[model samples]
Target: MSVDFGQIRRNEHLPARIAAQIGSDIQEGRLKPGDKLPTEHFLAKSLGVSRSVVREAIAQLRNEGLVETRQGVGAFVTERQSRTIRIDEGELFKRDSFRDLFQLRIPLEIEAAGLAAVHYKEADLERIDEALARMTGSEKWTDEGIDADLAFHRAIAEATGNDYFALFIGFIAERISLAIAAARARVELEEIVNVTIDEHVVVRNAIASRNPKAAREAMRAHLLGAASRVDLTLETY
Candidate 1:
């Protein structure tokens, strides 16, 4: 069966949008299991995007277990039974899923912050500072701001010296960022952006000081504040 690929109009989150489009094609049976996907060059040309965007989209599908690449060949759809944990981005923004996912995220990130405080190298600190600086400098409620926000969290996870922590946090943060961007769209108040930047600064300072307790508390506080900004009422501990 031939897949009907469309031109990508929006510039923001190009890889994610492409991944979603191709994933929908798979789920709807336009692309069947074991069927090889078009080459990166073909997809880029058909979709009016760069080859790098197609590559990133394919990477996302691979991470979600929807596609597998053969060495020196091409990517193919995976059997449904062999697929791993799949997160539907559309469903994730629903209120219950958003709140529940945020709850699960809290403790994992708090622990990561503590571990980062103890384990972070100078380079890790520099990465975190750079992300924070970008967030502080960006326009309020923009995609660039959101990307910087996620980068700050990802940097902290990387600093933990645990590959699993970085992996899991990176996965969760990618999904959660979609919901966060949606929430920001709804509430585009300058005050909220200022508060978020302040919260990140506190977390950065705690980690830099090598204070595990302080780092954990700062992370918890920042996350809770984030929930409030999104109008989510998560149970506070």
Candidate 2:
């Protein structure tokens, strides 16, 4: 049998069809907030779907918080839904998917730390030490913690003397913030930051000691430790 993508959409079962049309209507602003949807029967007839299908589609929208239903009145549109969607060649923004971003972070960060150990200058070490001090006095480990934490990592990346890898660090900062925000508590944040600082110091010390292998090892330990602490589903990757 032949297949047509457009026909497939047109022939989709009732619930999916209703969902697509309503979703499209909302997308096109034909369905504005406070707009009452037609009754289930009307929708079913109009869309050539069973009333159950209409109800199911409405339920789906309700679950998405795009519509509100009164006890005996009707379903009305709500504000348009928003999703975590953006494309910056390289930039960080608050988002809902940090796990995916962390997948890109730990290894890149650890590797950058190792490189920093090899290539960092006295000035670089001083800069990193200053950033580290900022972490030492921090109280709550929330957004402030995330800022300090990413800053420390960025410092290591800068110490690496590689600009592109540092760009990778910039890419995931916001995503890491999401996971960091979901952490155990403020103290937990401080603890992780402290632990990371220790790891970073070890890496830096190894580099300063001119032990490249030890620097790499220390960097790896820091990231893997972070993975375990964060329960990063992406640690294995």
- Please state the error at residue 51 of candidate 2 in Å: 56
Clashing pairs in 1: none
Query: On residues 21-89, what C-alpha lDDT tens digit does candidate 2 reach at each position?
Result: 686686588989889999998987877766755775675465445677898998988865532122331
Q: Model 1, 1-237: lDDT tens per residue?
A: 111111112232666778888999998999999999999999999999878668767866876778999999999999999876678775664568767888889999999999999999999999999989888885335666766777799899999999777767766776666555555555545876888899999999999999999999999999987777666788867
Off by over 4 Å in 1: 1-15, 25-83, 139-141
> TM-score for every candidate vs. truth?
0.73, 0.52
Runs in model 2 deviating more than 4 A are: 1-97, 138-142, 184-194, 235-237
Candidate 2's clash total is: 0
Give the candidate number with the greatest lDDT.
1
Model 2 reaches what TM-score against the true structure? 0.52
